[model samples]
Target: MTHTIRRLLTGTALAAILAGPALADETIDITIVNGHPPIFLWVKHLTETFIPTVNAALEGSGYTINWTEAYGGTLAGVGGELDAVEDGLAEIGAIPTVFLPTKVPLQNVTYNTPFGPGEPQVVMEAMDALYAQIPGMAESWHQYDAEYLGGGFALDNYILMTNFPVTSIDDLAGHRIAAPGPAVNWLEGTGAVGVAGNLTTYYNDIQTGVFDGVIVFATAAAPARLHEVAPYVTVTGFGAQSAGALVANQTWLQDQPEAVQEALRAGAAAYQQAYIAEQTQRVAAAMATIAPDEAHLHTLSDAERARWAAALPDVAGTWAAAADGEGLPGTEVLNAYVQILRDAGVPLVRDWSQR
Candidate 1:
């Protein structure tokens, strides 16, 4: 009995010595917010990809996170994501930079130079390369007290969804068309009055005749059932857009352990992969629904597409000039973006960098 008791005590001491410190695990609480609801593919990725990826990455580490997710205006409204993170209302968020162009102007590089590539992955890759090559691009997020993680721009090649059939560019004359973000500029020379609007309100607004049509992607139009309200989907091919990103408060991010920060970045990368895959599939599937005759879908003729592109003012140059006035490397980014796409063999409709 004495020998047994002595052995037990020795084992206990050995265990305590081996433990070194208390090894108390740390738990981090983070709140993620998005202006748009989960129905949007990007928002869905927050729950399905970002959160899960981060959680999985943290496993077996000495730290874990307890996530509190607030989406769809629960925490912030459209164009309010930057403020939410800057004010620490939320530690992290997927900010749609298209809505906050003044704050994240560099992020809108794709928006300024439109009609480049149709594939989201190509644009995403170019943007990623820009973030690495251009210091100012990443610094734009720092200005908002946020750190940018890898993700994508969700907007695919935009089309015009209208109540009236659009057989030609002239068909849009004097019609009040809804356009989200800088896309309103795309209608400048088209003779269409572009009213500012978004996906969430496109249906009701169109139903009530607030706007005759909306400039939107097929994937979004299909899911929102815009076809039910507006049967005409004109494939204008305005361009795919890199419009949003996952950003975390810089103060909060800087305070985290290295492991936690890495996990967050990993989660963001996963989000980019998942988003591109799902968005590609959705676009293809949505195209099937928008048939030639049944859905009143019309792909603008090549000649007409070029005519429309030529009629537009030097919008990309104007955008780059504005950024330069604000002390950003606007022209450099613009030139690099166009060059990257050109090198990748993306057939651009117009040479936006020529101006």
Candidate 2:
């Protein structure tokens, strides 16, 4: 019994010596920022899904992240997230590419080619394909000192919320409407003057007559309470758009350990799935919340959708040409984008690639 006890103690000491002293987890500080508040699906996922996912991934990895979440324009205002991350004001951010059209024009392909797929996941997959196919697609973000982490932050199918009823595209005539970023091109030939605007100002702008209506997504409109101001919800089906992405400061990301980098990338992937799933589930509910009465909602007919698509100037072609002028792979990206949709069997109202 004595020899056995001695052997057991010796084995325990040997194991302890081999293990060495316990090392405390290396704590890394990371701050994530977004312009929109936690109420929005994207931002909500960052807090609920992304950070948690990163933390979960880091488990037992001998590292821990001390996270600081700056949201609701606390760290960066709408359209300023890219600047915030690039300038190192925040280590990471949800950069709305729609707001940075000139800086990241290729990311705006969906906006330029409207009336495509309504499903956000389809649009996101196409974007993923584009990023892989076009080297310049990633290079564009690199120019801003930001590393694009694919979170696939896509907007739901865009709808028009107006104070006036839109029985058809003709009803949009002579009214001023607001569209975000390159989406203004969608208003061409509709006779409605398109003013550049975003979700932050859509409610007040319409209430105060800044514009008659706003081209916005249902998920956002319900939260922004645009329904109270613009009760007429026209389901324009402008198509789900790849609007923004989760990005990190390139310098900061480069400095991170490989495990840390992998954790962040994994977190981004999980965030994308969570955000899309929640956004998709909320879309119908949001539409109902916006227009509770059947009279308040009008889905533009397929014919009207086709007419609207036909009426627009060759926005995709124009955008691509401009990108090519800048020596970026604009035309290539556009063609690849449309082709991906075609291959996926998404019914397109007009093939922007044909133009």
Candidate number achieving the greatest TM-score relative to the actual structure: 1
Models 1 onward score TM values of: 0.94, 0.93
Query: Cα lDDT of all candidates, in order?
Result: 0.87, 0.92
Collision pairs in model 2:
none
Kindly list the per-residue Cα lDDT of model 2 for residues 1-355, writing each as its tens digit: 9999999999999999999998999999888898888888888899899999999999999999999999988888999988889899899898888988898899999999999899999999999999888889888888789998878699999999899999888998999999999998899999999999988888888999989999999999998999999999888889999999999999999999999999999999999999998999998899889999989999889999999999999999999999999999999999999889989999989999996
The segments of candidate 2 whose C-alpha lies over 4 angstroms from its true place after superposition are 1-21
lDDT of 1 at 252: 93
lDDT of 1 at 229: 81
Candidate 1 per-residue C-alpha lDDT over 1-355 given as tens digits, one digit per residue, 9 for 90 to 100:
9999999999999999998868767999999998888888989999999999999999989998889999989999988988999999999989888887777788888877766687888889999999989999888788779888766555788888899999788999999999888878888888999898888899999999898999888877887888888888888777888889998999999999999999999999999999989999888788777544754878888788888888888989998998999999999999999999989998888999997
The candidate maximizing lDDT is 2
| Model 1 CA deviation exceeding 4 Å by range | 2-22, 290-295
